[model samples]
Target: MIRVAILISGSGSNMLRLVEDMTGDHPARPVLVASNEPAAGGLAKAAALGIATLAVDHRDFPRDRPGFEAALLRPLLDTRPDIICLAGFMRILTPGFVDRFAGRMLNIHPSLLPKYPGLDTHARAIAAGDTEAGATVHLVTSELDSGPILGQARVPVLKDDTPQSLAARVLTQEHRLYPAVLRRFSAGDKTPVMLGSEGLVRGS
Candidate 1:
């Protein structure tokens, strides 16, 4: 079984979706969930689901990113996860830390990518008068959100849509797309899965 370690922040909605989808007959198993905040709601949610959870509070270390990651790596390394999934993980990981996992790390971003690579994605899309907005699952390259795309699912920017309304819709697609992509990913298939108007299309 492929061992997956999920990193989360805040409510961990995506993390929960990943855990739920990876059960019984799935190609992977969620072995651990780690957070940068001790009070991250996901920690308790993950623990309640019987998965191991750990937190290395970044705030405690002030500006010491390396130190925080080092402490976070303790429980992480012990799990021997085959892959690390960043599900709403808020911390900006250092290159050294991200490099250690390299291609083994995956992240779900809130945009179609090669477009909006940072925060305020939905609002920006609306301001630009985009007809469609979406989410992407990609490799965790050193550059933030600049990773090779693995899969993407688009959602229409409905008429008179606010950022909040648009975000809610895109998030739903993220929950579905992330899991489907993961199932293929764990099976050693990195072919891009595009969920668009044409339905699910596979690419080389």
Candidate 2:
């Protein structure tokens, strides 16, 4: 089984799904859940599930991104993770940190990608009159949210959809897409997964 480590910033809805799905012969098992915020709700959730948790409070290193990452690296490496899944991990990792794990790191973004790469993605999509909003699971790279895509799950915007509503739908897709991608990815298959209504049933 692959030793998977997940990082989170806030409520770990996606992180929760990733952990739950890695059961019953799944190729991966979540061994650690790390957070930048000590009070992040996800830490509690992870602890409840009996997974080891780490809190490297970014605030402790006011002007030192590298320092914070170094602190973050210690616990992450201790787990000897074969895969690092960034599920809503808010911090932008330094390139040196990204290089440490390279091909083994992955992230889930709340947009179709190459379309919306940053925060407020749902709001931006609505403002742009986008008929569709979705999620993308991609390899982590130095550039923000510009990594090679591994999977995408699209949801259509209603006529009067607000960012809040659009985000809800897209998040549901993310919960599904991230885990599906991770399962296949753990097996060393980077084939793009396409999420359908019934679930991730095909590769692109």
Candidate 3:
């Protein structure tokens, strides 16, 4: 079984889903949930489920990127996680920290990715008049949301959809895509791929 660690900054709805999925007959289980904020709701949710939780306040550390990352790495390394899953984790990780985990780290983005890589994906998609929008599960890399994609689930963008409505649709896809991507990664399969101007192509 793959021992997983989840990092969160907010409500952790995705973390809750992952825990529920794994506690069943799944091949991976979240052994730890760490949050940069002590007040993160995910910590409380993890406690309710009896999962180990840790809080490492990033703000307490110096502004030096490497120094801050070193403090963040302690609990994660101690957990000895097979994979680190970022679920609503708001901080930007440095390259050195990302390299330590490399392909073993994963993140669920609200956008289809390579399209709306950063924030406000729903609003951007609507403003750009995109016909399709969705979620992406990808490996974490030095570049923001530029890593190889593991899986994606696309949702149609209706003409009258607002940002909130569009986000709701993409969020539903995230719930499904993230667990499926974890299963694939745990099985030692190559992460899925998507080509520019083309759609998804299965990786060998």
**Which candidate number would show the highest lDDT if scored against the true structure?**
2
Predictions ranked by lDDT, top down? 2, 1, 3
Q: TM-score ranking from best to worst?
A: 2, 1, 3
Q: How do the residues 1-204 of candidate 1 rate in per-residue lDDT, one tens digit apiece? A: 999999998888999999999988889999999998889999999999999998888898898999999999877999999999999999999999999999989999988998899899999999999998999999998999999999999988988899999999999889888888898899899998788733455453
Q: TM-score, each model?
A: 0.95, 0.96, 0.91
- Candidate 3, residues 6-105: lDDT per residue as tens digits? 9999999888888888856677888899988999998999999999999888888868767767877887788889999999999999888999999899
1 against 2, candidate with superior lDDT: 2
Worst 10 residues of 1 by lDDT: 195-204
Model 2, range 156-194, lDDT digits (tens) per residue?
988889999988888888888888899899988999999
lDDT of 2: 0.92
Candidate 2, residue 124: Cα displacement in angstroms equals 1.0
Off by over 4 Å in 1: 197-204
For each candidate, the alpha-carbon lDDT, in order, equals 0.91, 0.92, 0.85
Q: How many backbone clashes does candidate 3 have?
A: 0
Q: Measure candidate 3: CA RMSD.
A: 3.5
Better of 2 and 3 by lDDT: 2
Report the lDDT of model 3 for residue 81: 95
Q: Native-vs-model 1 lDDT?
A: 0.91
Instruction: Give the winner by TM-score.
Output: 2
